[model samples]
Target chain A: MLFDKFKPMAEFQAELAARDVVPFGAVTEEIISATEGVVSGRRVILAGTNNYLGLSFDARCISAAQEAAGKWGTGTTGSRLANGSFEEHQALERELAAFYGVGHAISFTTGYAATMGMTATLAGPGEVILLDADSHASIYAGVQLSGAEIIRFRHSDPEDLAKRLRRLGDRAENTLIIVEGIYSMLGDVAPLREIAAVKREYGGCLLVDEAHSMGVLGDHGRGAAEAAGVEQDVDFIAGTFSKSLGATGGYCVSQHPELETIRYCIRSYIFTASSSPSVVASTRRALQILQEEPGLRQRLWENATRLYEGLQGLGLPVGPSPSPVVAVVLEDRSQAINCWNALMSAGIYVNLVVPPASPSTNFLLRNSVSAAHSTAQIDTMIAAYAGLLEDGLIRAR
Target chain B: MTQYQQYLEFMLSALEARAGAGVTLSETTRLVADIGLSSLEVMEFVEKIEDHFDISIPLNILPDINTLGDLARKLQEVDS
Candidate 1:
């Protein structure tokens, strides 16, 4: 009876196994490049990975990581509070603060820890948190643990956020508003300008999670806030090095002096071991590369546009706007699974998302483009999708 | 009718529309088990309730709520 709750999931896994469709956690046998990998015994174009800038396999980054590993060993054996605060960690923090033009920055072992810790610690009991309904699970977990009054406005609807704030009235000043720069599922972006304007009117601190948008957006790669020219309105920014920096870590940067004090109070930061020296070194190198090479961002955008246009030309239902992430929407679960399997068979790998993981009840075949994808590679993916349409596996929207 | 009764009446009507008119609703009726509302549908229903009552229901309270009576009681607490 203790395991009764897992029965449904077990049945679902069994069904998927019977169908020979392993959508989730398909192992990568060998990483050929930033944009190519041998997955499930087949060499496939890696489209589902969130490696936006494609710096994972850069020789410079690899060299930095190797050098750090040789100098500092493989891992930090203690938490930051204990003995894990290597000079590299502090240096990376300072660099992150400088990059964001913020007064303070704190790094975490994982993006989930950063977002969750910030969300949980920012507001407390009796205070309110107005978050987008489509927030990531990390944020939701943080809010549930925070003991704060968690109110979810409709996803990306500034009007709904305004309405909720209006109801709060005097309590609005104590509220924390949270939104992501680029939503993960559909690859849709938040209207940061409008949301920031609403925050200005409501008098609440705004936190923007730039996990997917950092190093992909803005002239300086400061994410949606910089792109929207509303950086001043944003109070805190949480992001991950895993996506763009091609490393494993997360950080929160803020102009507020209190952030330094708040760092001591975050259990996620205090209890967990800090990032290893190699990860920090590689992340620092990646950040430098991101700043020095603006052409990478341009190429990323161009690849995104090519994929978006190619999918649109095929009449596939894609996201609202063209970003590095392009997801094709489907209503039927079986059809979505078949299409995902078909793409995998065709040497193209993408993410198969079904509800309630998806933003809505619909299924999504999510593709993430990278700067490393050559024009020919992009066309190959498009051709494969076109084949799916011709086979009637997926219908044109 | 008291405000709580009015709220219950509205909820009953809404459930009847979704779960069929023949089904019965009471304070003990479980929203998910009895009415078969999916997670999304529950949120939509909560939004509808918030709009009708002109109140913002904190999602933090949902885990503690299961039966219709629990929701009505929680609504009353927040409404006040």
Candidate 2:
């Protein structure tokens, strides 16, 4: 049978069904209020969302989205190469390029496509791609599409990367090294300075995916590249609007004048429909908010530290640092599931990540902090976790 | 020892570092279940071998490889 090869997956699903825990495909009943939602018939605090700046429900952003939808209709209805590109889209691109202080910027439908399109088109035949071992799935998919030789250096180890690039020798000229600003699963930031140094010494293009770092790092929130003072060193910066921007789209900005060439070459850009008018409008407003209000970033980091310290105070295993994303490392899958269920029952929502997606073999309970979370809400979340620990629903390391 | 023999020994040493002291490794040993190397681990090991030999093995050659013997033979072929 055509489906016979997936017996193992079927068995796994059956096992999960018997356990009454379908961690995947969980549905939210409704979003009752900002940073509060109804899930599984209860009001839950949304601690697992990527709304870092918490601009998703901002009055200005909402108003812009509504006005844009009323003015330009909903979607572009065509690929950029055809009739999809609108004046608003180009304006957003210009705003983004100026935001990053780059010469050019290109927008895509989603952050995944930004990485996919840029990596897929940038490196060609006979070229090589050396990426961090713990890069996001979008990066892996992009490399696979490029049909270039893929080499993975040790995660965040510039020494290992240097060795690989040195081994490539003159072929390093055609090599593209990819890394991320903040790894989503573990919430660890990259050592961009070290990586940028390696790229400077070795002749290779450096692409930094700042999907999780933009609006969360640097004084101007340009991400790890700017935070590390290596903005000039990085050749390209890829980011998404879904997280901090409070919209749905992806963009790549570069100071390189040739970045315009990607518009004609990237398949993902040329084939798929552009972002909706509402999304572009809201994203532009969100960008303005991100810059104008630095307190949002400050409050976000404060909330992050509070949450990280709170989790640590409970003696639970946490990720390395206090970024917007805080991952609670678990010993096993059963333990992770139990903890997730317990948190859900307590009206606190968080994400449950397992193997393949997780950098290590262990499961992770990922909590993403936002600026909108009140001090009382943060304290409430901590108390819920404390209750879970007291009830023996979850364990400390 | 021949280059293939030396390479095999080096590969076995790297595997033992991860698999611990009691692992039984041979040229005919399956790199997956028998040695307990995940797909990602196998790829990393293959990359190490490529670096040691200063040869770029096409990614297409991966699936055809299962055992240490197969890897050694492929390395020899590429080097020659």
Candidate 3:
């Protein structure tokens, strides 16, 4: 009976197998560069990976990782509350805090853990969480585990948020408003300026998840809050090293002194092992590079605009705006699958998102552009989609 | 009218608007199986109900709801 719940997934897997199409989790045999990889015995452009700044293969980051590993051995071997509280972890925390100009910073083993821990622990039963309707799965999981009375507003609609807050009345002060800097699915930036204005009127703690927009937005690359000039109004800023920093970790920075105390109460942080020395080292190097080189961010935006314009020129249905993420919308699931397979055959790799996983009922062929992508690579991706359009695998809106 | 009855009436009209004018809707009418509402449609319907009642329904309650009666009763529980 417990296994019966997986029947739908099993059926889907069987269908894919029958079609000889592996859309999800296609393995990469070799990573030739930040922009290129070998998959299914064919070289393809790595467009689906969320390597926004493309510092994964940087020489400085690699050297820093090697040096840290040589000096500190391999893993931390324990949780931060136990024997895993190494000097490197604390240093990275301090560095993140300094980078955000916040009072406290806490790191987690994975980005999911950071968001989940913060969301679950920040508010408890008898409290409320007002989140965007199209929030990430991790945020949804956090709200469920928190036992909070969760309310979802229409996506990016500040008026809807204001209405919900009004309904809460005096209880609004006890609520936590969660929104992302750049929504991962559709590449739409949250109207943080309007959101912060609403928060000012309603009075609630604001938490912005800057996972996708941390290294891509803002003059100093802080995140959407910074770009919106609402950093002072935001109570907490959660972000990930896995995206822009090209490493594996997540963190939450806040100006409130209570975050230092809250870190001890987070079960995910206490129970999970700390990030390894090498990862911390590389992340530190990547953060430095992010600050030192503004050209990477510029290049990333240029590449994003190029890909978005290219698709739009071909009359493809793309996302609302062009950031580093550009997803083409599709109404037909089978047609989406066919286009994905065709792109792969044409030496390109992208993420195929279907219902529920996609923000809406429609499917999405998600592409994440990186600063490492050359102009040629961007054009090649465009040409592949054009071919799909020519072959009638996809149609314009 | 009882709160449950009011909720049922509202749900019936809503379902009728989507399913068709001549459709039948009872308290026991299944939302998905009988009326054929997709997940997105269900969420949209819930939002409409929330706005109508001026209530913030917790998403935690959706999984337990199968029929119009279940939704109405759950709505009454939240309203209380």
> Candidate 1's residue-wise lDDT over A1-397, tens digit each?
8999899889878877887989898999999999999998999999999999999999999999999999999999999999999999999999999999988999999999999999999999999999999999999989888889999999999999999999998999999999999999988889999999999998989999999999988999989999999999999999999998999999999999999999998999999989989999999999999999999999999999999999999999999999999999999988998899999999999999988889989999999999999999999999999999999999897
By DockQ, the better pick of 2 and 3 is: 3
Off by over 4 Å in 1: none
Candidate 2 lDDT by residue in tens digits, A321-388: 78889999987887888888888888889999987788877899999999999988889889988987
Best-matching candidate per DockQ: 1
Task: Kindly list the per-residue Cα lDDT of model 3 for residues A265-353, writing each as its tens digit.
Answer: 99889998999999999999999999999899999999999999999999999998888989999998789888999999999999999
lDDT of 3 at B36: 87
Candidate 3 Cα deviation (angstroms), residue B29? 1.9
Clashing pairs in 3: none
Using TM-score as the measure, the top candidate is 1
- DockQ values per model: 0.91, 0.32, 0.76
Candidate 1, what DockQ? 0.91
Docking quality of model 3: it rates as: medium
Which whole-number lDDT from 0 to 100 does residue A297 have in model 3? Answer: 93
Model 2: docking quality category: acceptable
Task: Give the lDDT ranking, best first.
Answer: 1, 3, 2
